[model samples]
Target: MSHRTVNFKGNPVPLEGPELKPGDTAPNFRLQQNAADGLGDATLDDFAGKTLLISVVPSLDTSVCAQQTRTFNQKAAQLPDNVAVLTVSMDLPFAQARFCGTEHIDRIKVLSDHRTADFGRAYGLLIAEGPLQRILARAVFVVGPDRKIKYVEYVPEITQEPNYDAALAAVA
Candidate 1:
C-alpha cells in the first residue's frame, strides 16, 4: 500500500504524505516570487501571530485555480485584520499579479515558488512523477496566530477544489 504521486497535464509529481491535519506545525520554508514589482521572499515567520490561510494551488491560470483564489480573497474581506490569507502557487509572480489586477483580488497575497520548490516539498503538496512534477496539490491550511495548523484540507483529486467552508471555519 504505497501512496501514489499526483499528475498535472500528464506529468508526475510526488506528494510527501497522505495528508496534513490540525495541530501540526506547518513545515517552515521560503517562497520566491519574481514579480515585475520586484523579487519577494517570505517564510513561515513572516505570517506568524496572524490567522493564516495558506491556499495551495497547482496553477493560477485555470478556472478552478482562479476560483479558489477569488473565493478566499472574498472571504478575506470578512475576516479580521489579524487574519492573513495567502494564496501559494507555482505560477510566475507576473501572472499572479496580473490575475490579481484583473480579478480585483487585493485582500490576499499571492506568493510564488518559481525559484524554489521548497514550499511544495515542505508542505507535502508536491506531486511526484507527473507532467506537473514538483507542482503543489490543491491543499488548504489554516494556521492559528501561534503558527500551529488549525485546519487542513488536501484535495484527493488534483483536479478538484479544496473545502472552502472547512478552511474558513477552522479560523473561526
Candidate 2:
C-alpha cells in the first residue's frame, strides 16, 4: 500500500509502493522492449555507467503524455551522452514503437511497462484506483552512475507536466 496520492483531473487516486527519494538506491526493474526476437527485457543494468532520466507517463495516445515524451526526446540531445533519457508507459511494445515512429522520437528510448509493471511498482507511481488504474502517474527520476537516485518528482496532478528544469539540473 502507498500513502502517496495524485490527482487525476481533480479526483484523488491512490498509488502503490514506496515513494522514492534522493539518495535512495534505484530499484532494478525489468521492462519490455519491442524487438524482432519478440519482447526483450531491459533492466537498469543495461544502462550501466550512465545517468538515467526516467520519464513516466500513463499512455502515449494521450496529448499530454505524447508531449512529455517529445519534450524529453528534444532535451535528450542537449544533455551529455552519458545521460540516457527513457520514457516508460503501460502501452504495449508495438504501440510504443508506432508512437516513436510517428512522433519522430528517436533520441529518447520509450519502454513499455505493460508486461510486468515492475517499473511502476518499483518507482511507486502505479495508480491503484480510478479510471486510470494500473497506469503510472506522471513522474521523473534521475539516477546517477552509481545507481543512487539524485532526484524524484511525482507530479501532484496527473494531467500536468513535470518540472523538466529541476530534473535536468539534477543530472548536471
Candidate 3:
C-alpha cells in the first residue's frame, strides 16, 4: 500500500517506507539537540557502534509528545548501557530542555530540529500540510549497532503514540 501524505504546520511531506533496512546501511543524519549541558549538535556517527532508539515526536510540549518521550526514557533506562535513546523533535532547544526539566526526564537524549528540519525531512517524518505545520508526525526507528534500521513504526494519526513494544524489541 502507498504511504500517507500530510502537511505539518505548512510544509508538504510524504511518508514512505524506509529506503534503508536492517541489513542496509542507515542513512547519516546531523541534528541539533538540547542536552543537560547545553545546546549541541550530533550526527548518526555519534551513535555508531551502539544500539539506537530514535523516537521522533511532533513537539515536546504536546501531550502525545510528552508521553512518547517519557515512555522512551523509561525504556531506555532498561536497555544496555551501550544503547542510546534519542528523541528528535521540531521544538526549540530551549523548549526541549525546559520540557525535560519539567518532566524530570534524564534517560533519553532530546534532539531539536529548529535550526533545520533536515533530520525530519530525511526520515520522512515532516508533515506536508496541517495545523501542526513544519512539525513532524510521531514515528520510531530502531537502529542496530551497525547503523541499520532494525525496526520502524510510523503512527497513522499525527497525535498517536508509536508501538513502543515492537520498537524496543527490535533493539533487544
- Relative to the unseen true structure, what is the C-alpha lDDT of residue 132 in candidate 3, on a scale of 0 to 100? 56
TM-score of 3: 0.86
For all predicted structures, in order, the TM-scores are 0.88, 0.96, 0.86
The TM-score ranking, best first, is 2, 1, 3
Model 1 residue 166 CA deviation in Å? 0.9
Per-residue CA lDDT of model 1 for 1-172, tens digit only, reads: 2275554455545685446568877787788754567888888888778889899998988898899999999999999888999999988888888889999988998999877777876777876554566667888998898778888877766777788888888888
Q: After superposition, how far is residue 44 of candidate 2 from its true place, in Å?
A: 0.4
Candidate 2 or 1, higher lDDT: 2
**What is the per-residue lDDT of model 2 for residues 110-143, given as tens digits with 9 covering 90 to 100?**
8888977778888998987768888999999999
The better-scoring model by TM-score among 1 and 2 is 2
Cα RMSD (Å) per model?
2.7, 1.1, 3.6
Ranked by lDDT, top first? 2, 1, 3
Error of 1 at 50 (Å): 0.5
| Candidate 1, residue 133: lDDT | 65
After superposition, the stretches of candidate 3 with alpha carbons farther than 4 Å from their true spots are 1-3, 6-22, 35-37
Clashes per candidate, residues 3 or more apart or on different chains: 12, 0, 14
lDDT of each: 0.81, 0.92, 0.78
